[model samples]
Target: MVTGQAVQLDSRSAWQRMRHWAFAHAVDDFYQGLVPASIPFFVLERDYSYVAASGLALAATLGSSLPQPILGVIADRWRMLWLAPAGLAVAGIGAGLAGLAPSYPLVWLLLLLSGIGIAAFHPAAGRDARRAAGDSATAMSLFAAGGSVGFFLAPAVATPALVSLGVGATALFIPPAVLMGFVLWRFQQRQSRNPVAAKHSGGRDRWVPFLVLTAVAVVRSVISGGIATFLALYWINHLGASQALGGAALTVFFVGGVAGTLTGGRLADRLGVLRTIQIGSVAAIPALVALRATPDPWLGLLAAAAVGVAMNIPFAVLVKLGQDYLPNRPGTAAGVTLGLAVSAGGAFVPILGILADHSGPQAVLTALCFVPLAAVALGLLLADPSAE
Candidate 1:
C-alpha cells in the first residue's frame, strides 16, 4: 500500500515537471515563429526586398542550427539546467530587440542571437524532459505539441499587434519570455534540490538504427518544411483561393500538427513507438498525394490537415525513439533529431523555392508527394528498441 502511494505521488510529480518543460518549449518556439510572422511587417515597414527578408530568416536559421549538436554533447557531459532559462531569456530579448533595431544588419544579428538561444535551450531541455517523461511517449508528445501550439499562435498573436503598431509590437512579446524564464529557473532549482534519477533502459547504442531514424527525421522535415513554405501559395495560386482562405488552410495544417503530435504520443503508448512511426510515415504518402490531386481549395484544406496530421504522427515518437536507440546519449540524440536534422529541412526549402520559382507551387507540392516515400523506406529499417 505504501509503495503504491509512493508510485502514484511520483507519477504526479513527473507530470507536473513535464508540464513545465512543455510550457517552456512553447515559449521558446514562439520566438522562432515570431521571426517568420514578423518578416512581412519588416518588408512592409522597412521596404526590405524579398532577398533581404529571407536573409533575416537565414540569420536566425544559421544561429539555431549550427551550435546545437555541440551543445547537446555539452549537455550530456555537464547537465546545464541553467541553459533552459538563460537560452529562453536570450531568445525572447533578441527577438524583442530586433523589432526595435535601427538597421537591417542589426535586426538580422538580433534574430541570429535569438536562434542561438533556441539552439542552446533544446538539448538541455530534451535531456531533462526525458528524465521527467521516462518511457511515456504521451508525455513527450505534450512537449512537442507545445511547440506546434506556439508556432500556430505566433501569427494570430503577432499579426494583430504588428498591424496596429507596426514592427515595434514585437517588443511586447519580450515580457512572456522574461516571465517564463524566471519561472523555469525557479522550477529547475526546485527540481535540482530533489534530483530524480534519469530512466533509461540498459542497452547498447545501436548506430545503424539511429542513423536510419535520422534519415527518417530529415525526410519528415523536408516534407513538412515544403508544405509549410508552399501551402499558402499553393492554395492561392494553384487552387484560386483568397489570401484569407490560404491563410486559413495554413492554420488548419498547424492545428492538425498539434493534434497529430499528441495523437502520436498516445498511439506510441498503445501501439508501440516504432509501429506508430511506421503508421505515420505510411499515412503521409497518401495524405500528400490527396493534397496534390485535389482541385478544390476547400477540399485541399481537408487534405492539408490530413497531411499535417500524418506527417507529424511520428514527431514526438522520433524524439523518444532516438533516445531509446542511443540510451547513453539522450542529449545528443535529441539535438540531432530535434535540431540538426530538422534544420536540414530548411536547407532543402531553398531548393523547393527554386522549384516553386520555375514549376509553380503545385509542382512543388507534386514533388513533395514523392518525399515521404523516402521516410517510409527508411522507417522500415528502424529497429524497435523494445523488440531488440
Candidate 2:
C-alpha cells in the first residue's frame, strides 16, 4: 500500500513537471513561429525582395540550427538547467528588438539573436522532459504538442498585433516570455534543490537505426517546412483567396499538427513507435497528393488539414525513438532529431522557393507530394528501438 501510494505520488509529480516543461516549450517556440508569421508584413512594410526576406530566414535558421548539437553536448556534460530560463528571456528580448530595428541588417541580427535563444533552450528542456516523462509517450507528446500550439498561435497573436499597432506591437509579446522565464527559473531552482535522478536502461547506441531515423526526420521536415513556406501563397495565389483566408489556412494546418502530435503519443503508447511512424508516413503520401490535387479553395483547406495531421503524427514518436536508440547520449539524440535534423529541411526551402520562382507555387507543392513516399520507405527501415 505504501509503495502504491508512492507510485501515485510520483506519477502526479511527473505530470506537474511535464506541464511546466510543455509551457516553457510553447513560450520558447512562439518566437520561432513569429519569424515566418511576420514575413509577409516585412515584405509589405519594408519592400524586401524574396531573396532578402529569405536571408532573414537564413539568419534565424543558422542561429537556431548550427549550435544546437554543441549546446546539447554542453548540456550533457554540465547539466545547464539555467539555460532554459535564460533562453526564454533572450528569445523574447531579441524578437522585441527585431521589431524596433531601423534597418534590415539590424532586423536580421536581432532575429538571429532570438533564434540563438531558441536553440539554447531545446536540448536542455528536452533532456529534462525525458527525465520527467520517463518512458511514457503520452506525457512526452504533451511537450511536443505545446510547440505545435505555440506555432499555431503565432499568426493568431501576430496578425492582430501587426494589424492594429504595426511592428512595434512585438514589444507586447515580450511580457509572456519574461513571465514564463521567471516561472521556469523558480521551477528549476526547486529542481536543483531536490534533484531526482532519471533511471536509464543501459544499452549501446544503435547508429544505423539512428541514421535511418534522421533521414525520416529530414524528409518530414522538408514537407512541413515547404508547406509552411508556401501554404499562404497557395491559398492567395492559386485559390484566389483573401490574405486573411491565407492566414486562416496556415492556422488550420498548425491546429491539425497539434492534434496529430497528441494523437501520435497515444498511438505510440498502444501500437509502438515504429508502427505509428510507418502509419503516419504511409498516410501522409496520399494526404499530400489529395491536398495538391484539390482545386476548390475550401476543399484544399480541408486537404491541408489532413496533410498536417498525417505529417505530424510521427513527430513526437521520432524524438522518443531517437532517445531510445541512443540511451547513452539522449541529449545528443535530442539535439539531432529535435534540432539539426529538423532544421535541415529549411535548407531545402530556398530550393523550393527557386522552383516557385520559375514554375509556380503549385509546381513546388506538387514536387512536395513525392517527399512523403520517401519518408514511407525510410520508415519501413526503422525498427522499434525498444525492441532492440
lDDT per residue for candidate 2 within 1-388, as digits (tens), equals 0000000124465457589988898888888777777766676688876566667766777777888889877767777778879988888888877878889999999988988888888878877777777888888898888888888788777867876777767777888888999999999999889876544565777989999999999999888878877787787778888767777788888888899999999999999999999999998988889988988887788888898899889999998888888777767777788777777787787788778777767987899989888998988899767576
Q: Indicate the residue-level lDDT of 317 in model 1.
A: 96
Candidate 1 ranges with C-alpha deviation above 4 Å: 1-9, 13-17, 40-55, 100-104, 197-201, 236-244
Local distance difference test values of all predictions, in order: 0.81, 0.81
What is the per-residue lDDT of model 1 for residues 146-187, given as tens digits with 9 covering 90 to 100?
A: 888876677667767887898989999999999999999999
Question: For candidate 1, what is the lDDT?
Answer: 0.81
Root-mean-square deviation per candidate: 4.2, 3.8
How high is each candidate's TM-score? 0.89, 0.93
Which is the leading candidate under TM-score?
A: 2
- Clashing residue pairs in candidate 2 are none
Clashes in each model (backbone N, CA, C under 3 Å)? 0, 0
Prediction 1 TM-score vs. true:
0.89
Q: Please state the error at residue 341 of candidate 2 in Å.
A: 1.3
